[model samples]
Target chain A: MIPVLRAAVNTLVHVPDLVRYGSKPFREGSRPGSFLADLKARLRTFEDAAAYPPHQAFIGNLRPESLADIPSPWYGHPLPGASHQGPFGEILGQGPFYSMLEKADQFGLVSLDAGWTPPANGASAAAKGLMSAGARRGTEKEIRRRIGSGEALALEHEGALIGCIRRDHEEDESLAARVLLENLAAKASGAHALRLLLEKARLPAEEVDYILSCSEEAIGDRYNRGGGNLAKAIGEMAGCPNAAGTDIKAFCAAPVYALVHAAALVQAGVVRNAVVVGGGSLAKLGMKSHRHIEKRMPVLEDVLGGVAFWVGPDDGESPRLNLEMAGRHPSGRPSTPQGMMEALVCEPLARAGRKLREIDKYAVELHNPEVTLPAGAGDVPLTNYRTLAALAVIRGEIGREEIPAFIRDHGMPGFAPTQGHIPAGVPYLGHALAAMRAGTMKSAMVVAKGSLFLGRMTQQADGASIVVES
Target chain B: MDLDNQATIKQLVDAHGAENLVVVLGMSGEGVRIAAETLTTGDPSWAGPLAGVSLGLPVYHILEERVRTRLPAEIYAEKVQLMEMVLDVAQIEDALAGLRKTQAKRS
Candidate 1:
């Protein structure tokens, strides 16, 4: 069996307006020099404390929301205005992370206490300051001179160009995806981040049997371009002859689903190993930051995107794939809070022949409550987990009074960016794996739920679950 | 007869004597029609004497009406024995041999 998720790292990339909470308009001179200076100072303070290496920070000024303004068929909904509050608040809030941690605690889920939070203002000045004093500190004049000369705008945090995000003024989704991947690959030295991940796992290029990637769409000269070719890309990138790709598109649930898929492939002896990787997008970041920036609220500035992952064999002792279950209700059925909870949790557990109290922790839809709870009923993941816990208690699995403690112990408030699949499924994998390895908990469940009505194409609700055990 | 009826006839032949005798081979739609035509025309030079036959929908749906309208009346009236066989490479090889023998006798 593949070992559980060993470690993970993530970064969020966003425009200045998103970082500043819209008080500093995109147009120059909108904010006085003093205000800009103070803003920069606050950003520098937080940047110092963020754990990422200095070279990894990449800044972009152009807002993706502006480019995606025109109505397009590919998007599930009309792109929101630049100032919408919902996406931003949810992506940056600490409440979700707190709630998830609380839930995990309630269920006796053990995770690393070394969790990192993005600065209140998205800035890395503090991190830049930590670099060696001898490193070159180019002034704005030098930076402007380079931009004016039409040279490649090299972004330096302490002093290196780890990655960059460039805008492709193209309408075609597939072509755009290719451009982004190719651009980032070239800048990041042939996608060294992912290559390093494979190397760390001690998985040879030739031995790699499959690729499970979480790209939003698949299509290209690349393997499985549309939906099922992530493995192929990894194979090609890793220089493995047997590598091929497949896609999983459940927004946040994809990585866990991909993990389950890789495990199954190993069990079936189809191939000895597989890799699941996701490339982040700028469009999904700072979605609601524009609104906060406009309202002069604290802009959640950490918008640098990076990928990290899980690698191992199926049926092993380090971390075992203990259980996986999914719950979904077909569209058009009457919305029942009770029924939804049962379908989302109880039914799947029953089918797996497991009871509620037997599992140590249950990680359910742990999205930020500040972003989701204010929207109304059926918006928050924590609510769903609480309801499920209540149902489990009512079903006599535990005492009714234990619901509060159960939630507090079993959940983690959402600390992930609202990058769809990034936060929802895989964010907790790293910490959960570490805990399992330490033998703090025997087993934990990662659950995800998505709203299908937003797409309007289907009336079906979607969910998925996976258990990690030591 | 057109391709659809010819395919049906070929299926029938394979089902019956193909296994019992030996050797089986698949022919193109056009090839089956030509073989059926030679048999229907009472030409002694035609090689194969079919012992059994079956019919199936032609692979191409566009040819259905045309093949259906053109089938010979005598072939339609002939009762074919049906035999279900599991498809495997060895079984297919055996059926082909039977077809060759039938063709040799007819010729």
Candidate 2:
């Protein structure tokens, strides 16, 4: 038998207010007359915690498996019974999130005491559960002066003033306040997700042996532009005293790559329990606001998504990851859709002597259609499924007519936010684990693809896939 | 959006004449409309050789039945079928049709 491991726990965090500071729109929208300038008004169009269905789903308040039965357009149907807290994690608002920024700040950069009063609501009190013990306190006078001098940006929640994030350096554009805030926000959200994994999985922080940060954040100053050690930083913030780790970058596909890496480490006995975590990307927020605003829909990309998964030796009860059957897109292979499907889906199954229909579900890029369609980016996960089905048709595994039914039975409506790596492939792990544990499903495969051209170094596309079996 | 693309299309139209030319676009979403309008009513952005040079050409998206029906069924299935399944065919076709109707009215 191949060395098998289990995904013990996972969590996703939704931080809406961080959009203004970390998103491309707010950064580029500052230019007068830019088309993105309209994003400021569009930011005001974000749905609150209770009213947003996607946010509800992200925090585990609603089961992702329930979306198919809700309606064709899931966003239009609000879950009135949704709450801020969920079995997995919570959807934090700007008020408490500002406090997170202050607490997450390792440097004396973030200050919440200035004009920041805790909201008289239960959400704030609940968010307090996520704060780290190493919080740095700052004076309001420093934040106010920085904002007055254009050195810092004010944090706002529900149109009210809160705290602010300040720049580390005086002159380096790379160390600008907004850029640092994006890094800190990633740290804050990643730390929150790790904490949730420890709490929800009932695993103590000290038990974690290692971590793999797959977030798209490029944390570095001008000297080493893209160099980083976010994994260690997140571990520190989450109180993983014994855990040491590093980042694994492959653009959006990094999460699944990290997943396989962690599983391999555990199987090889290099480490006991390895955690794969990715924080949200701030730059991706409001990426398609122009289309959303044109369609008169809410700015759905407002949320910063973070996800963490704990991988450990199979305990016989947890769903087992088939490490030997993992698929990878080789550099020598063609990058066409068909070619990619062969490498990432077909070849692995062929080697494992499994049929395409054996897999219960396929999770690819799970970007919500509500956020992508208006922006002209088609339903991402649906496209991946169709491509897989089309390949099956060519292989005589299924007839052309069976494509529709195959897609419906084996794929799902994407519920994860368009936060790059967050939706790449791992978001569905929680649901898959649940279904497998309940014996409702047997196995699921996660496929993650990345556009290597985004880095300007290569034109090749990258992809990786892994299967989990009950 | 490229000046070279506009120049190439202008040369092709001038050599073959606009009456014999049909621009088949393989674009998706909002880009389908702009690409079709550029071929029919000239470049909408007014920054290329096609600017104000109304070719009045009939444009069809690759996902449209008009184009798909003309291709060998097997070839279409092998090459374009997967893309057609993934793309928003209805939206792309509607955008092309809307531009074609506008061009018809102008002529």
Candidate 3:
């Protein structure tokens, strides 16, 4: 019999940093009166003004209790731990081989192996010269200190050590997405790592009944017209002849959503075995690292994107997909964006009849704090999770008094500067599965949210939650 | 000029009084109605006059159908353009003068 979800693993590699050696170089011709410059200036003003003393002054200017009432998961949690020094070198030293083995052993990942291509010449030169030079010379100490103190930055996985690729530098979104996916596919050589994991589990390629890929991309696309096409590219490379990829566009919640979909397919007798995989993209990494790069932040380049998995049987031992509930709300609603998120995410989970306190761990929006904080939003995923928890209490799923303790017990500060897909949803699956298997927890939930406004047409916000049971 | 929906090409030419009138035909819709009125009335404001007439089906039918299918209640106007074809630029200028005469009479 095939095991349900035998194992899951996540690996975050550090990328090299970009080095800028001039007075903050604004885009040429983007001087006063230019729309681009004006927008940048406005954003800079808001970011700077937010950091002023007398937090109450800014707070007073807004509606009373506006900031206070908004619940956040990281609200009183200690700042996240600092990155281990020698970022990329430290990651290389740790190696995917060792980390995967250790994690697999802990999670009962039956057959497992890991590998990565070394940084390319350009990447190595930039890493050594730009990244190390900037750090040693203290050129961006304030930014680095913030990063050291957990400020988020954009990150992209180029050829080697994940680095901060500037979003503004990209001329075309489609081309940028294609390059990012191609770079990731080239590095892993597609299907080799998957095959190794399958072999360790004693499963053959053809026996693999279905494949659920969770990298971030729009569904039903023809070419590079939509989001990145990582699934189609990897599926072709893996040669799973029966493979048909479905996009789980739920941002970070993707991996878990993929896991849930695979489990459901297996339970329905559709496929005997399935593989859930996602590769990191440079664009997502770059967006997260942008703030740090602009300020010459320390550890500005350690965000690396990596692929991971959960391979198991249609029916066997391990956590099973018990999708107790799922929810979504369209963007046309006149309600506030926060209200939209609650209706789509928090309400559905509550209706599933699971108390917030009953859930041993709630994994939602695990975006790297360092990557998002410098932009002034704080950890998005953590904030969403906390809000859900608070809503649960308000709804009587848990006592209002227990909300604080529940959040404190169940939350994680941040994971890595991986893209929305990396830390947002799937990172905790491995740990959650392990805890379930060990009977430490009966169930866990993974939540992911995304903005559809990026398309410029849809004001819609969407998210998904998956329940896994041991 | 109230041009009937089923008006013929000859009738349109006789009413407009152009020696070699161009009759651009299209499926019955906003474009067709506008073209018929402009041909009958010979008003430059409503529709430009034609020298050597041409008839073609409506270009906006597909777009109209699509919009109708998706948002039936939404009101949308069809964009249409008419041009006169003459033997030369000089004849084109003469057509414009004839068009002005008809327009002036209507005003």
What does candidate 1's lDDT look like per residue over A312-388, in tens digits? Answer: 56435466764455444445443344555566567767888988766677766544433332222223555555666
> Model 2 clash pairs?
none
Candidate lDDT scores, in order, read: 0.43, 0.77, 0.43
State which docking tier applies to candidate 1: incorrect
What CAPRI grade goes to candidate 3?
A: incorrect
Question: How do all models score by TM-score?
Answer: 0.52, 0.88, 0.52
- Can you give the DockQ of every candidate in the order shown? 0.01, 0.45, 0.01
Interface RMSD of 3: 29.8
Candidate 2 local lDDT, A1-470, one digit each (tens): 23343443333344455555545667555777765545555563323534566666666666665677787555567777667666666565555556666777767777665445655234533346655343454466766787899878876666555567778888877788888888888887888778777877878889999999998888899898768889999998888999999999999889989989998998888988899888878888878876787887666777778888888886878877788789999899878787788899999999999888889899888888888988777778888888988777777889989999989888887888888888887888877777787899889999999999778888899999999888
| Candidate 3 per-residue C-alpha lDDT over B26-82 given as tens digits, one digit per residue, 9 for 90 to 100 | 232233434444454433233233323333222122223333345333222111110
lDDT of each residue in A1-470, candidate 3, tens digit only: 33356655443333232111111222222355423232223221111222211111111122111333333322222223322211111122112321222222211211111122323222222112211111111123333343343222222222122222111123554333233332442223223334433443455556666666666644223354544445555555554566666555555556666776776676666767777776544444344234554554432323344444554554455776655555455555533434644655566666876556676677777665555666555556556555665566545676656756666666655544445565655556665665666778776667666655555766655666666667
Q: Pick the candidate with the highest lDDT.
A: 2
TM-score of chain B of 3: 0.23
- DockQ winner among the candidates? 2
Over 4 Å off, model 1: A1-193, A217-231, A234-242, A294-297, A304-308, A314-316, A323-340, A368-381, B1-107
Could you tell me the lDDT of residue A379 within candidate 1?
30
